[model samples]
Target: MDDLAVAIGLVLVIEGLLWALAPRMGRRLLEAASETPESSLRLAGTLAVAAGVLIVWIARG
Candidate 1:
């Protein structure tokens, strides 16, 4: 639970920094994402999750 909280917090900080530093880019990205197909988005999300799990597993070991 604590690890999950920390991971969520880190994600928020990274996302916040991107928007803070590059607001226009962030907006453009969001717009692009909105127009992106759902299947593509889901595939990207699935890959991200798998990569994250792999990272955590390696880090823990």
Candidate 2:
């Protein structure tokens, strides 16, 4: 859908800005994330999904 494509594009733009402006910090964050436990990452990802859904639902309403 068009909305999904725009959302993906926005994510890419935000991520690109981080790497472009602070490559070192981005690399360090990646390293930290790699060292983080799988369970923590999974929980964080789940929370992010829930939050995103809630935001969209509220915005649409």
Candidate 3:
């Protein structure tokens, strides 16, 4: 759907900005993520998904 495309584009733009403006920090974050435990990463990802869903639900309401 059109909304999905726009959402994906927005995500890409934000990610691009981070890498462009703070390449060193981005690399550091990537390194930290790589060293993180899988369970912790999973929990963080789940939380992010829940937060994103809540944001979208509120925005659409």
Which has the greatest lDDT? Answer: 3
**Candidate 1 residues 1-61, lDDT tens each?**
9999999999999999998999999999999999999999999999999999999999998
Ranking by TM-score: 3, 2, 1
Taking all chains together, the TM-score of candidate 3 against the true structure is: 0.97
Q: Which stretches of candidate 1 lie above 4 Å from their native place?
A: none
lDDT of 2 by residue, 1-61 (tens): 9999999999999999999999999999999999999999999999999999999999988
Clashing pairs in 2: none
Between which residue pairs do clashes occur in model 1?
A: none
Q: Please, what is the whole-model Cα lDDT of each candidate in the order they appear?
A: 0.97, 0.97, 0.99
Q: What is the TM-score of each predicted model, taking all chains together?
A: 0.92, 0.93, 0.97
Which digits, one per residue and each the tens of the lDDT, describe model 3 over residues 1-61? 9999999999999999999999999999999999999999999999999999999999999
* Backbone clash count for every predicted candidate, in the order shown: 0, 0, 0
Model 3: CA > 4 A from native: none
